[model samples]
Target: MRIINNKFNIKMISENFGRYKYNEVDKYIELGGFIGLKVALEKGKQHVIDELKISGLRGRGGAAFPTWQKWEGGIRELDEETFVICNADEGEPDTFKDRELIAKDPYKVIEGLTISGYMRSAKTGAIYLREEYTYMKHELETVLELSREKGYLGKNILGTGFDFDIKVFSGVGAYICGEGSALIESMEGKAGKPRLKPPRIGSKGYLQMPTQFNNVESLAVVATILKMGASEYAKYGYGDSIGTKLISICGNVNKPGVYEIPFGLTLREIIENVAGGIENNKKVKFLQLGGVSGPLAPESLLDTRYTYEDLWDLDLGIGSGAILVADEDMSVIEYIKLANNFFHHESCGKCIPCREGVHVYKKK
Candidate 1:
């Protein structure tokens, strides 16, 4: 999704979206594409991790886990066959942010994964793309090919003697595959269902090799942070949040699209200023923050800052950074019905509450 020009702070990963086309390697190079990896290499390995630690970058795929911790864990795993994976299966109902990152700045993701590969000492990287986004697969593959030819993805990258390569793994159209374990299981030719942790992704991820699996946005932002430096990149967000966030705003909004707002913006500011206010000037009654699993934020919470720490106090999350706004005319029951129907379909019959609870709501 090419960002429609708006007077908002869409920095870092999204600065080049509509300004330039990312179809060619030359365009990417001219616009400073692989500089992050170059700077990362120059900063030395430990400092690279240190910068991530200082950046306060968190996982963007709903998990809200700190990016630096994941990187540190991956680095700690001393397996030669470790791998880095990008979860490109953007299946969240209101979340389509990852697709933009993949479609527009494919090379950025490549550079991010390459940097991740170096950090984790992993020689292989994979992007688990959604089946519906097959259109972008070819474009991303083309970028990767050109990157390899230009000494970005192959052996002896930039003559650093570090070898890493990336491949796109087409998904099987299962929402559960968004889970890291399920994704790995599907990749291994098995049913895509959540597996027990303990043998976590870092220890026994893809093919039992230590893996650092990050969402597309998370890894792409890693590339951006590498270039901007921790302190400079930390300038945008609210107290302790510290970064920009790509929020996919939909439903009852006048200009519904992805808007990259700095973290900690009130829901009102985003819905009013960023999304051009609610559609038809209708008063927003409630919001579905994140996707179905996220909180049902009432209008009273519109003033609430968008942050994991703040939202968690109210039992909410920044799941994929998606906000679905509903006007006063929208029925609350209908929303529940839709949520129940979706969860009913997605329930893998793993637990009683989720398995039977959705069904009960559907019957109501």
Candidate 2:
């Protein structure tokens, strides 16, 4: 897991970089590992949610949904048995930031989940790890055990009477399972397919109980917001989309690793400057923001800012925080064909539009 540090990089979540080894519970605690959970416990649930609201942090996994609203929705639900799920299903191509976060700082993610569990009064939390990351399951389990021994997890955490514990659930490598409802379905031991939404996951999910799903990055940031205070965390990014985002840059770029960049940086700066420009000095043909499902942009649109408002205005999104650059060597038809092939093979075949529509496009 390579982290690129630059003038544009902000060390909110990645603050543990170079400071501690992975799985070192004591070292993590030295650097304020469970401070956010402590803060959440001390300040109370509403204070935690209020800090998130003031922080202006949105979901880091594609959708820029307000973090506070999701937590609030879970609170409003009357279910006594609710669940907090961290979506570690990094099924999208070229997006590995979540995996990196889990590998490098699993404790931060655990703390985030614990804070969320406290906020939502959830007794159980789960990490929906993608199957490809099965190797990490053991390490994560080890960390969870250590956290429990140290009183960070398990019954009556820190004497706060908040009984919470987390378990890792691995997916069967289905891309469609990345969807919120579909992920819940897979967690429930059913076929991984998107469910029709009338009662949203916030209302009924995961064993037909109120459930709150948050991306790995989104939940991780929750701890940071609580630790640093909302006003402090909100100082980093552009309007509306506050805080830094972890982007996984691949394809034609020279530096093709995960980067923690502040929002509002131009795409041109990201591709040419942060990512070390096109490989072999080749001319860029197009760029894909988010993942394969994201919209493509020609070189002409490279100057656009990477904010949620800016991307949404152009009918694009920062989905999955994947920036795939294609140079002149790759043809537009070839790229579209490759993307269609992925959808065709990975579609859960639950809906006619996605199932049949993807097949038709692949055949074309």
Steric clash pairs (candidate 1): none
User: Which predicted model would earn the best lDDT?
Assistant: 2
Question: What global local distance difference test value does model 1 have?
Answer: 0.84
Per residue, candidate 1 scores C-alpha lDDT tens digits across 94-204 of 989888887778888889888989898888999999888988878888888899888998899999889999998999887888989999999899988877878888888
Model 1 shows how many backbone clashes? 0
lDDT of 1 at 107: 85
Q: After superposition, how far is residue 38 of candidate 1 from its true place, in Å?
A: 0.9
Reference-based lDDT, residue 17, model 1: 81
Cα displacement (Å) at residue 324, model 2: 0.4
Which residue pairs in candidate 2 have backbone atoms (N, alpha carbon, C) closer than 3 angstroms, thus clashing? none
State residue 257's C-alpha deviation in candidate 2, in Å.
0.6
What is the TM-score of each predicted model, taking all chains together? 0.94, 0.94
After superposition, candidate 1 runs with Cα above 4 Å error: 1-7, 356-364
Worst 10 residues of 1 by lDDT: 1-10
lDDT of 2 by residue, 215-280 (tens): 998878998888888887777777777778889999999999988888878899899878999989
